[model samples]
Target: MARSYQDVLAGARERIPEIQVSELAELLESEDAPLVIDVREQDEWDEGHIPDARHVPRGFLESRIAGIADELDAPIVINCAGGARSLLAGVSLDEMGFRNVKSLAGGFSRWKQDGHDYTVPSTLTPDQRARYSRHVRIPEVGEEGQLKLLDSKVLLIGAGGLGSPSAYYLAAAGVGTIGLVDDDVVDASNLQRQIIHSNDRVGALKAESARQTIEGLNPDVSVKVHPFRVDQTNVLELMNEYDLVVDGADNFPTRYLLNDAALMTRTPLVHASILRFEGHASVFHPYEGPCYRCLFPEPPPPDMAPACGEAGVLGVLCGVMGSIQANEAIKMLLGMGDTLAGRLLIYDALSMSFNELRIRRDPECPACSDGAKLEFRDYEAWCAGERGHAEAPVSA
Candidate 1:
C-alpha cells in the first residue's frame, strides 16, 4: 500500500529529527511553546544552559527520545558550551526535515553574557517565584489555568483501568467535582490497574468505591457517584453539568453515544481507549473543536476490539494515559495552554513512546462541518446500520 504524506513523514522523523534554538525560544514564547532543549551533555549543561531547558545529550538523543513525555515532534532549540555542536545538530535535524527549528546564537556563553537566565540541574524550583515556577511560567499555562484546575469539574465515564488513574489525578489536582458513571462492581481483577479502588472495594459499587477513593486522596474534592451505565438516555444530562468529560469507555456503543451527546451539548469530550499496549487520546467538540466523528467519521464495529475485560492492558500504561487525559482537562478549563483540539496523541506503552497526529476538521463532517445540521441523532443505530450504514457515505 502507498503511504500517505503523513505516514511518510512520520516514518522519516521516526528515524531522525532536527533542532533550532532561536526558533525554539520564539516558539516557547509563542502559542506553541514553553520548549527550550539543551542538546549538550550533562557536564556541558552543568557549565551553563537556559533555565528549564531539557537536557538530552547528542550521544543519547536517538536512543533516549522515546521516554520523553509530550516531547515527540515538538520544536527544540539545541545548545552547547559553544554553538558548534548545536549547529551540527540543527543541520542534522533540518536534514531530517523537522519543521520550525533553529540553533541558539553563541550557545550558553551568549545566553549568559546577554543575561538570559540559567539554572542548575535543569530543574524548575518553587522558590523561583510563582510566576516563573514551571507551569505558570509558560504563556500556555498561567495562573488562570492553575485556578481553573482547582475549580473544574470532570466526569469519567468508566471505572476500570482508564478511569482509575483519570479519577486519581483529577482528585489530586483538586478538581471541584468528579462524576463516576459505571454500573459494574469493582473486582479483584481491576486492582492490577484500577489503583484507586482496593481489594476490599471489590463487589462494591464501582462508582461509589471510586468516589470513596477520591475522598481519601483529597477530602476537598467532591465526588459524585452515578452508578448507572451512561448511554443515550442520560449521558447528556450527566455530562451537561460538568466542565469537561473524559470518555474512558471500553465499547464502541457508549463511545459513539457519548460523542453524539457531547456534540449536541457543545461540550468538550476527552476521548481515550487502551488495547493491549497501545492507546489513543484526543479532545473532541462539535461546536468549538474537532468532533470525534470528524476523526473516525464512522464508528468501529462492536466487537472490533474485545473488551478490556477479555484483552488485557498494561497496568501502568493506563495511569500514564489517564494522567495525560487529566492534564488536557486542566489545560482546557483554565483556558490556558494547548489542549489536544486538532491533534491525536497515540502511545505505545510497552516501548514508552508516543506520536501526535494532525486532526483536521472535516468541512464535510455531519456534526460540525460547514454544512452540518448539528442535530442529535442515534449513533448506535446509525453505526449499527439501523438507517443503513452506507446510505450517506462520509462526504469528504
Candidate 2:
C-alpha cells in the first residue's frame, strides 16, 4: 500500500490539511460550497462513494488541476476510501500553493454509509446567444471588462425592482463572483421592470434564477445564490467580502442596515433609489468620505414617500440607473476616475435631464462621527424617528 500521506511525507503534515465529513458538509451548507475531490485510486471509486464528488485519481491530480484553475478560491476537500489518500492529495494540492485545501477525514465510504444527497453531472442546453453579444462588442467594455466581470464578486440584497437592474448590469458586466440574496420567488408582475428575470423564472427562487440568468448571459461569471433576506446579524459578514455595497432597497430598514454595516467595515457604499421617472445615486464611505447619515441624518416617515410599486416607475429607468451604478463600480475597481463621492446624481427620465448635487457633511452625524460612542441600535427604530446624527470628518 502507498503509505498514508502523513506517513509518506512526515514533513507534508506541515503542508497538507485533513478535514472531517461533517466539516466538509457544513462548509457546503454555508454560503459557499467547497469542491469535493475524490483522490482515491480509480479502483476505489468504482465501488460505492459520495455524491457530487469529482474523480481525480491520486496519480494525476497535480497535473490535471490546471483545468480547474478558476475554482481555486473555492474550498477544496479531498477524500479516498478511508482518510489516508485524501491527506496525500491535500499535500500535493497544497505544495502547489492552493490557498484553501483539506482532506476528508472519514472519506467516501463513510459518507456513503451516512447517506448524503449527490448527483452525477448532466448536460444542459446552451444559453441564447444575444444575451451577452452587445456587451462584448462595446469598445470601452471589451473582452477585458468581460473577463474582469467574470472575476468580480458582488452580493445583491433583493430581487425586487431595484435588485432587478443591479442584477442585470452586474451579470452583463461579467463580475467574476456574483451572489444574490433574496427569499421571494419571481412573479409575473415583476416582468414590467425586473428584466434580469423573466416569466419563466416566476415561481422559482429569485436568487436561483438570478444565478441562472447570469450563467445564461455569461457563464464566465460565477454565481452564489443565497435564498434568504439579510438581517443585522448577517449583514456585516456578507458585505465584508465585497468591494462595494449597492443599496437598491425600497425599505429604510435594509438600507440602514447596509449603511451601518458598511461604515463598520469601511466599505464604499453606492446608494440608488428610483421612483416614478426619477433616480438618485451617491457614494458613501465613512472612513474615506462623508456617509449617508452625514447628509440625511434620519429616514423620512414611513408614509411620507410612496414606494415604486405604489408611486409607479418607468421600466427603462432601471436599465439607465443600473448601468450607471455598474459604471461606478468599474471606476472603483480600476482606480482610474472620480466617483460620485460626497455628491448625489439625480436623473429624470421623463425630461431626460440630469442634476448633480453636492451634499454636505454634518458635524453632528451619529453613524460616521466621533461625537459619541452609541451602541449599535436597532435599524427600524433608529430610522423611524427624525433624530439628527453628527459627522466625524469628511475626506475627499
Off by over 4 Å in 2: 1-149, 372-375, 384-396
> What lDDT score belongs to each candidate, Candidate 1 first?
0.72, 0.71
- Candidate 1: segments with Cα more than 4 A from true spot: 1-146, 376-378, 381-396
Identify the candidate with maximal TM-score.
1
Per-residue lDDT of model 1, residues 1-396, tens digit only = 988866754454444333344444556666876456567865666566687676667775544444432434566666766666665565556555554455666777777776565675432224322423354434344333444565678888998888989899878766778989999998888898988899888899989998888888776578888998876568778878998799998777688778877877778899888888988999996667788878887766556657777878888889888888888877777775678888899999778788999988887887677787654555556666566744442321
Report per-prediction Cα RMSD to one decimal.
14.0, 14.1
lDDT for model 1, please.
Answer: 0.72
lDDT of 2 by residue, 210-302 (tens): 788878876667778878777766777888888777676777767776877788877787788888899998888666777887877677777
Look at candidate 2 and tell me the lDDT of residue 283.
81
TM-scores, all models, native as reference: 0.62, 0.60
